[model samples]
Target chain A: MKWALSLCLLLSVGLIFTPNTLHALPEESGKAELWLTKMSTAFSELNFRGLVVYGDGDHWESLEYRQTQHKGTHLSRTQYLSGIPRTQVRSGNELFCIHSGDHIAGLTPDVFKPLNRDLASKLTTILASYEVGVFSNIERIAANDAVFITLTPKSDDRYAYQLWLERTTGLPLKADLLDIKGDVLQRFQFAELELNVTTPISMFSSSESGHALRLKPTPDRVSSSEASWWPAWLPSGFALQGYNKVSGSEGRQGERLTFSDGLSSFTVFVDHVENDLGPDLTRRWHATSATVRHTRSNTGDFRISVVGELPSVTVSKIAESVTLVDQLASR
Target chain B: MTDRKNESLSALCDGECDELEVRRVLNQFSSDPDLREQWRRYHLLGSIMREEPVSSIDLSEGIMQALDGEPMDEVPARSQTPVETSVAHTAADNKRSRSQWLMSGAVAASVTLAVLVGARFAYDPSALDGSMSGAALVMNDSQSAMESEAISAITVAANEPVVEPLTVANADISAEELRKAQEVLSQYVLEHENEAINANEQGLPTFVRVANFGADNKTAVRKD
Candidate 1:
């Protein structure tokens, strides 16, 4: 009888204290912070497989890609669903753009200024820059319960974010890429995700799987003492990352210049105009994120194309302000 | 007794009283200072409840000092029992799990919509070229299509000088070979342009051109 009375007393005490303990707001805040930290950590460290949709302008395409980061090496395989089926295999900085009629070998610079580290560290910036607090209760994501963390953009330069990360693995199950107007510009979601699965080496194909034209060793591949000849009035935070001089089919030389603004990059091309006249007068769309600008000088007509996830104004500005320094004088 | 009425008056501060009760309370407070004191007491209790942190609120030093004066220190100290906390947590966890299930379904539906729409607009380059002007170069009467083709092909390969009318080779090569050679050179130029764009480097190097083949000498100028 004495033990039963004591147990009853303990149960009442527990019931009374439970509400008081649950009412503490700091504990809830701590839980949210932990969830965000875990989500960021997995993005960089984990190997992920999923289908992604990429779009620019009106051109949108769905693709299946797998990204693996192991032993400090990053590899990806991209398969396109368009005509003359193509597959792009990338390991580290190298990519093979494979196709039936043609295959092109490509290289992107190291220290890809955009998304500097992995996706994980980028999320930390999201938490820091925004007043990150749960706007409501837990939300559903990709058939799993996820905390819907909506980050309102404080500035007009960038977009807002609505991230849905998994409750278990803390991986981003789905993400909505938004524009300034809060409209969904693009969407990258995991239709299916497997974490830490045994991946086959054969899953990665050599870029040479398609018919390859015997590529001549391009003149741009040949090193020259003539890099400093051309310079640009690059925007603040932009850096010259690479230089390649390709000879045109007519055996004329063309210059490819790469610049990056810590996160995003733009490519600028300077070629001797093969046509007798200048480039087209009107602006037109090539792809979603690509804009081409043409200018003429006494030397030759120049074609400047700026491509990236940037405002078109930014690209056009970069293209127009470019000035070529005389190689002989610079040397 | 006046304080009891003032306690009711305190409830009146929250605009909780209905219209009839509000009139009654207003009439009663006007005549009683003792009722006013009760009203003050009621206001004080109401403020304290509002001040209780619901979510991560920082307690001011004064508030902490007031809390220090309370006799509930022993109760808060005992509040952190792991087993008891976990019991409340299980219920909350169940709620969260349901929410996750709902969110996942929404995400799957949204992703399917995005993918199906995205697949419709694959890049088609030929379809994109809407502006075709009269840009093709016109050939002179002295230049036959075969000779012109051969000259363009040579120019495409090594930026070599265009073949002059006077320097036409008597060597027999099929017209089909000449056309094939021209196509190969055109493709090379396009590929080279793509490479330069991707590399984002220097300008295209100078190619050799014949310039003006003099009517008398027909000399080729090897310009850099």
Candidate 2:
């Protein structure tokens, strides 16, 4: 009886010192959040060049990537390995996406960036929706001691993510998107990465063989605003990032709205559904998903498409909540 | 619109009619043309529900009726879409490698019938093909599931002749209007993805994806 009592006392003492699995102690949670903020900054502040293997579903690509900060401006570039020549180079706000020696359809880099100047605060705001914690055991990545940090989604509206950060520099060494079953749906890991090395600024310039495409029809200019409809309900932490209007063939109107929660984002598209037929066009891409919904009203029938790195149900809820902004105000 | 005797005839088809109503329906079946037409339709529908082939020698009439009931032109023409093009390219490795689709000659005939329906009208031609019997059985409840599966098979094997039931939906929506809509939406696709890429410190992740996308989508356009 004395031995059993001592064992029970020892086990209880261990439990009291150890943080709970789902809910970390306040000090532990704050430290984890601080690490996440550092991870975000380390990626930008530290100059690194390495080969990264990115994956989504069954698709895989090997990319030679580099990021350099010179004179307070960020410069980044990515080149494909052993395939048709495709590259994207960004220097601060100037963006160039070259495909087969031509600038294909794409928006400016700033369009996708969060509206806030401070990325850390945006991440902090999103912490409400996630249960952030650090693993007790340290992991190794690319020859570096790393801490495993997990952002387990508090709700099903988002996916859980595990990121391994270099212990010394706090740079993200590996990232994985996990499904409810803890299965990795997407992964980006540096097979070989160099840390805190000075990079040549000219490395950010596009050096592809083909001439860049003329801006005759520059895609997604966000030049006009014919977006009469807006979603009444948005998920917690999501905010209206941007909106644009493009004139369609023969004077038709189309609207695009973007929303983001720092780490993830989605876009809603509204247009007239002229003779809309057949099944909803649902497709999943590397870390992205697209779903199209057809909505009908007395005034007209509309085709609503939601695209993002978000859960399908969340996107669907956002899409279903869309209503004509002017129409709602008047009513 | 509910004709009194036709309603009685419908009731008799459900096996719920009293003896007197059955006798009345039987007595009128010989003289009332509309009642006879309803009886024939109910029987045809019942066999379709049972997943049994309709013995209609003139399939053209059935095709025409199916087209009339479900407008073929009203489908959202979503083929040749950038998203699908990407899908086709990524799945190219797993796409059917064999040039010949392995199925009975009758199934091939069914595929030809689907093409004929698309060429003549906008409705799912494969549904009119002999496989329509199976499609009709599950279509009412799980309509969208069956339709998308049918559409994917049809779009993938568009150049090949291999048709089956539930693989006959025609999404040959009007091209120009569809291109306009897709063009508008593709912008959002890029914008949304671009934003995600922009958030990346190095743009290593999303930037390469765009390139792979370019390569994959190019294959889609070329194949299409």
* TM-score (2 decimals) of chain A in model 2: 0.79
Per-residue lDDT over A205-299 for candidate 2, one digit per residue giving the tens place of the 0 to 100 score? 77655222211122334432456788877878776666656444345666778776666778887766455432345444434566666777676
| TM-scores of the models, in the order given | 0.42, 0.54
Q: In every candidate, how many clashes are there?
A: 33, 5
Residue A136 alpha-carbon offset, candidate 1, angstroms: 7.6
Q: Rate the local accuracy (lDDT) of all candidates.
A: 0.40, 0.51
* Interface RMSD values, listed in order for every candidate: 23.0, 16.7
**Over 4 Å off, model 2:** A1-27, A99-101, A104-118, A208-226, A297-299, A326-331, B1-191, B195-224
| Predicted structure with the largest TM-score when compared to the true one | 2
Tell me how much of the true interface, by contacts, candidate 2 captures: 0.06
Say what the interface RMSD of candidate 1 is.
23.0
Off by over 4 Å in 1: A1-44, A53-60, A67-76, A79-99, A104-138, A144-171, A205-236, A279-298, A325-331, B1-224
